[model samples]
Target: MDPLTLGSIVAIVTVGVLFSGISVAAGLLVVSGGFLIVFEGFSALSLMPEIFFGKLNNFALLSIPMFIIMGAAIASTRAGADLYEALERWLTRVPGGLVVSNLGACALFSAMSGSSPATCAAIGKMGIPEMRKRGYPDAVAAGSIAAGGTLGILIPPSVTMIVYGIATETSIGRLFLAGVVPGLMLVGLFMLWSLYSTWKSGDANVLRATTYSWRERFEILPRVIPFIAIILGVLYAMYGGIATPSETAAVGALLCLVIAMVIYKLWSPTKIWEVLRDSTKESVMILFIIGAAGVFSYMLSSLFITQSIAEWIGSLDVNRWVLMAMVNLFLLVAGFFLPPVAVILMAAPILLPIIITAGFDPIWFAVVLTINMEIGLISPPVGLNLYVINGIAPDIKLKTILVGSLPYVACMVVAIILLCLFPGLALWLPDMVMGPEL
Candidate 1:
């Protein structure tokens, strides 16, 4: 069989197996892409040794596990609960204050953890109960957590950005820097949307309105300061050239561990073991996907699919903005069906070349892509965040979560448009911190 035909078969089968609820890693290695690569008239076993072994040896990939460990450590310690309490106290005086604070806390936690489910699990556990007790509707509570969880990718120390940087050979630290403004923008938009919803629905009184003395407000700072310190310290070290991205991640992990031990005092031996075990499991799952994706990507490249697709896109006479909008539309539709990680692994390689050819900055594209993926997490049917939040609060209908997420999704669309119209919103920090590319 022709290599193109074999490649197409592998791609289809792999995607089918995944969509059929089988493990993509297992599908890639055992039944689809890898198997095809091995048997497709190359030296059978030896020709694709690099696919089997070399791809998994990426040193930068080590950061995935370390970051996961760091996130799990902080999560298991319930540090996020404390952060939420502090934020609630500070924001409770405002309309829809609890929901806004939930968004804020999720964004902050996202900066440290870089995993959406972790953000949801950590914040949902506390945020849901608090909102519930405060008389917020289940849909509102679930929707807020689900939407806020999407911040995990847009914020810094994001695992998604790390994967993007590694895939595209872009600097992870620069990508991290690039995400800061846009991430905050998304948080602000979510907060505003929350406020608007509260106003329209007359739900402003759900949270107990309490005014704190300046001194009392200051006291809550002690609980929040550690998170701020960790975020600032990691960014400062990376921006100041004191540490590499991987090293910064390691330091962040260690700092989180120490904070859990000393300040939170929730780190027991059994708890530590649980964190390690869970992190390892999640890390292994991600790494396996990464390795398999590398293999599948190699197969696609070998078949000239990426090049052909890029050339086809380049030949189009459409306006660049139109083409770009089409790409966003495609991703938004795809997000409804595909997991964010899987979408990134498959689509980034294809779309990235077209983006570069159109003279778009890869860093800006990364942020845009991140936001689009976030949209997918709230889109119906397979929205991961909705399911996660629903798991935490099962009584809420999925339709309710879906409907509640629509306004936030509009906010994301607006954010994407703003970044598109002003690429500097995403690129400025990276260029300033990383220096303009020579």
Candidate 2:
């Protein structure tokens, strides 16, 4: 059989088997990757060594474990709970104030945790019950927590950015720096939407009319200062060239550990062990996916599928904006059924080259792709965040959370358009800070 047909068969089978949920990880890896090797013979098997070793030897990949450890440690601590209390007092005066405060709290926690599920679990445990008790609708309460959860990927110390940087060989430090402004922008958009929805619906009953004195507001600073310090230390060290992105992550992890132990008093030897164990498991899963994706991508390239696709795209004479709109449509649909990491791993190889050939900056494109992926997290049929929020609030229907996420999805669509129309919104900061090295 021809190599192209063999490669196409391997690709289709791999995707089909994985999505089918019948094969376990080891089985899928061996079956999908092994079949390609067996059919293609020893020369193709040689690529496995490169793919395996190349993924394992990456120094930047170290950040994955460290950041995961940091997020897990912080989530296990009481600091996150305290941060919520502090934010609630300050933000509760406005309409849908509690919901808005939930977004604010999640954004702050996400900057430290950098994992959406962790952010949702941590905040949902606290915020969901509080909102329900205060007469907020279930959909509103669940939706806000779910929407706020996505801020994890946008904020600093983001695991997704780390993965993207490692995959594309872009500067992780610059990606982290680039994400800050856009992350904050998304948070602001969510807040405005929450406020408007609440005001129009007159759902102000959930907000308690509480006032915080200057001293009280300042006192809560002690609880939040550690998280801020962790974020700043990571970004500052990276920005000042004192540390590589991986080293900065290591530093952040250690700082998070120390703070959890001394400042927050939540660390025990067993707790530390647990955090490490869990982080290792998660890291291994991600690394396995990366390795498999590398093999899959290699097969596609060797078979010339990527080249063929790129050429096909290049032949098209559509307006650039229309092309972008089409890309968004494709991603939005893909996100409904596929996991974000899988989507990135599979699509980045094909679409990224087309995007670059079309004169779009990869850094800017990363921002756009991330926003699109964020929509995937909340979109129906397989929306991961909706399921997570539902898991937390079992009494709330999935439909409620899905309906609530629509407005935020609309917000994400607007964000994409803004980034497309004015690429500078995403590009300018990175350019200024990284100095035009694209």
Candidate maximizing lDDT: 1
Query: For candidate 2, lDDT tens digit of each residue in 330-410?
Result: 888777877667667767878888998888887888788888888888888778899999999998999999988888888
Q: List candidate 2 segments past 4 Å from native.
A: 1-12, 22-39
Candidate 1, which ten residues in sequence have the lowest lDDT sum? 39-48
What is the TM-score (0 to 1) of candidate 2? 0.93
Q: Which pairs clash in model 2?
A: none
lDDT of 2: 0.80
Backbone Cα, N, C clashes tallied per candidate: 0, 0
